[model samples]
Target: MDLDAYVAAHAFEWQRLEALTKKRRLTGAEADELVERYQQVATHLSVVRTSAPDPSLVAHLSSLLSRARNRAAGGRTGTWRGVQLFFTDRFPAALYRLRWWWITTLVVNVVVTGVMIWWLLDHPLVEQSLLSPAEVDQLVNHDFEDYYSEYAASHFAAQVWVNNAWVAALCLALGILGFPIVYLLFTNMANVAILGSIMIRHDHGAHFWGLLLPHGLLELTAVFVAAGVGLKLFWSWVEPGELTRSQSIAREGRTAGTVALGLVAVLFVSGVIEAFVTPSGLPTWARVGIGILAEAVFFAYVFVLGRQAFHRGQTGDVDASLLEDRVATQA
Candidate 1:
């Protein structure tokens, strides 16, 4: 094929396709003509690639065909539809699909924390090593309870939210490293265990539980979810099953991203509880009850909505059409 002669013949059709694509509205005849032009230009591109193989011409035709294709396919989805789809399908399904990872993380961490607290209670020397006698007294007598009300509730809520969100984000970001996620979880649980031991030994066990449970229940759950998702991302590549390692990592990474974004809201709720409810004059049972309620609601959200979304084939990833096009290859 003579490249110059071919370009001369199809240039008009390409220009017409570009023009029709740029139109804001089209009459019936013009719409029909646009489709006709689009087909011609696509064919022109294919022939150029196969016969002439001019990079510049092929590139121009490729760009033109892309725009024409989007126009024919009705362009992008509406903003409301995208947002609704995210909450209804993407976020929840991701939670449900990765339930085991986070759930196991939550259980194991809780057990580790319990063991640490029990060990510290039995071994008094550990507390003295971690904190001086005066520091332990200060924390047990005043610091532990006062920490919640030290700042205005609203100010403190924002602060807690930002801090916890950063932790969750870090877990997700460092999850591929494997060790970092384990280190983060360990440090977090250790802090709680250390504090619990000091408080319980000082006869402030109920007080500690009162202040912690209201917010800790949901807050810790969010962190566990992040760690679990991160671990899943690490394992995705390690044991990719049938998919290629890259494919597995990419799939789990997207799910991790969804979990990360969703946890922001979860942490915010927990922050509110920690700031307001934890320090409130309500009975400990009531405060803990509210925390339990929030935690229950979250699990229900995952099991109910997430499970439903998963059953429908939702993998917490972006729409297939929106993902970049891929070319198949053989090993």
Candidate 2:
């Protein structure tokens, strides 16, 4: 395709475009010249990409064209449309892409939690080590039920919201560390297991389920999803496949950040339920029904809307315009 010669022929025009774009001030004629050269270079880049696929040449021309277009057009302002697009496309697609990771975490943690509960119940020594007979009696009889009603609903909701959000944020922010994600998730399972064991041991298992199922369904799912995303981020760089390690990390990091933001809303829902419904005197079945309903809606949001977004090729990553397409890389 004689790519070198083609580039050489248009080299002066390209140089002029670059110079005009770089200038802090430009004459009217120079501005017009920048637009004209930008168009010509766009055509050149297209020909180079089709006839001679050189990553270096294509990247260089792309960068020049991008700069020229920006100078010719000017900056775009943010709008409500950006927020709309985020929810409609990016956020859902990102979750759908990582569905398997989150689902696996959900299953594994649930199984581990059950096993821990059984282990604690079967071994008197384990339960004894955790809490003395008197303490266990108090926890199962009073503390477990009283914990929810201990604080006013409004105050409790805020506290739960912040605490759950912080835990989710920690899972997401420390996901790159790999082991931290595992540790964080394990700690969550242990807490649930300890409580479940104490309740079952005291023959208040129904009471435990009645209280836990309401908010626990959605709340725990949100936490699981956060931890899954974090572990996925760690795996991204560990096994990036075709992408360079840096590119893999950057892409996953951006997507993970979006997920963390999305979880804030999910956790908010869980928090509201925990404060109002969990502690409220709504019948146990009704509270569990509402929790299950909320959990169902979340899954539907991810599976239905998220699947649509993913199939349409939206990955919840930032707009292509925002990513530096000119990052030098070998083809």
Candidate 3:
């Protein structure tokens, strides 16, 4: 049959099938017939429309076919139970697809750290330029010993951490509007420059490890990750690849959001250390150990847990703790 005639002949059947599928009440025979008819109609429509069938339509048809097959094998079961199972199985998969932001953020962090390290090593004068005279005086006196102590005890640590978190969130959120991401990047770079300067000017560039290797590790890494997400969202608008800018932005936004949440968690931990540990005159070795442990944990969470969460959905391996006895036995 010609495409038009086939569409005309089956139009009412297709409409009825779609309606029944929406109601989730098709009988086995009726679903089977509808599936067969949908396949034929879809093939004909493809020729006429010169495009693939809509994915939603294909999903609906496949679902109806599955429902029919299930009914044939076993009389019936509650639809709500099936839906619950579907969501339980699929939520991880959804989360997995949304992990690109975390990965991207991690990469950005590494790059930023590398850049900061190189700048501190290569350009001492610029580092000197970055710090204020009072900061420079503290560095000369080795008085930063007390500065970290004050920071740990003061309310300022909490305020600083909160402000940083808000700024990071704003960067991610503003990228949605397209222009704010540029400003976000510039602001972040300035902050990095100031931090790098502090490390270099203090202790005659000798205390870099003491100053930054501790709390700076997680805190700076979080900042870089947040910046990376912002950059990705901004780039989505400027270079959207094959998709429309809006579509690309939306896709990247989901990943960026997850990464931002992870950053917030990092900031919370880092802030506590900065407020209480760094400033409290902890032994240098102790501070180093704490920083190293925190970084290790953060790394594992981002690279290991993050990857598993991303790919877990595709493997259909539910966490053992969440599975009931029947589900476990069936598996």
Candidate 4:
């Protein structure tokens, strides 16, 4: 393939790309020249990859191309348009791409919650071990029902949103450790299970489902999504596919951040449902129906808009200009 001869022929152009990459400030003409040489060197890298395929040369050109791509795209900008693009495109697309992770998380949580409920129901000892007879009675009768009305609707809604948002955030922040996510999910599911068991044991099974399903569907789903995305982020470092571990973690972590932010909106909706609809005078059917409708819309958003964005090559990562120029560790 005459690798050395080919390298010599185009060495000047490659050198120019390197020079432009390292230059702190570039003139307009030099900027144009940088782009030109970048493209030419990209072709050169392609030729070398196909003709000679030297590991060292390929890595060098790969890093150079990455830097050039970022430079040509320009650096990051903080503007309203960029903010608008992020929500409309990047956020949903990330959710769509990692839809499976969250969905699996939801399913597992539901199953775990159900199992906990079943175990408690079958074994009265477990329920009694967790709560006293009077305490359980109070929860099933007054405490559970009064919990909604005791707080002002607005305050309750805000509190619910904040609390659930915190849980989601914890999942993201601690997801890298793996154990924290599992512990958080287990603890959450167990609490719900205990409450459901208490209600059902006292012959208020219908009431339990009625209140829980009204907002619990979407609310729980958001939490699951958070945990799922967090787990995926951890897995990115565990098994990064073609990318280096650092590169994979960086990409997935950014995407996970998007999910964390998007989930705030989602949890807010669920909080509204829990505060207003669950305890309102609305008929059971209507209340549960609203919850179902909200959940459906979320699924549709992820599947429809998210799918389209993903197919168009959206990866939920920040724009290229906002990312590393050469997968280099930089601030």
User: Deviation in angstroms for 4 in model 2?
Assistant: 20
lDDT string for model 3 (17-56, tens) is 5554454556778656655654544444444334334566
- Off-target runs (Cα >4 Å) in candidate 1 are 1-52, 61-78, 327-331
Please provide, for model 1 over 1-331, each residue's C-alpha lDDT reduced to its tens digit, 9 standing for 90 to 100: 7899888887888888999999998788887887678767767777777787888888898888788777765533445776677788899999998889999999999999999999989999988888998998899998988999999999999999999999999999999989999999999999999999898888889999988999999999999999999999999989999999999998898888888888988999999999999999999999999999999999999999999999999989766644443422211
Superposed model 4: Cα runs more than 4 Å off: 1-80, 327-331
**Candidate 1 Cα RMSD (Å):** 4.3
For residue 123, model 1's alpha carbon misses the true position, in angstroms, by: 0.6
Alpha-carbon RMSD to native, per candidate:
4.3, 6.4, 10.8, 6.9
TM-score of 4: 0.76
Full-model lDDT, candidate 4:
0.85
Per-candidate local distance difference test: 0.88, 0.87, 0.59, 0.85
lDDT of 4 by residue, 169-288 (tens): 999988787789999999999989988988998899988888889899999899998999989988988899999999899888899898888889899999999999999999889988
Best by TM-score: 1
Candidate that would win on lDDT: 1
Candidate 3, lDDT over the whole model:
0.59
Which tens-of-lDDT digit does each residue in 172-213 have in candidate 2?
Answer: 999999999899889989999988988887889999999999
Q: How many backbone clashes does candidate 3 have?
A: 4
Checking candidate 3 for backbone clashes, the offending pairs are 96-310, 148-279, 149-279, 152-275
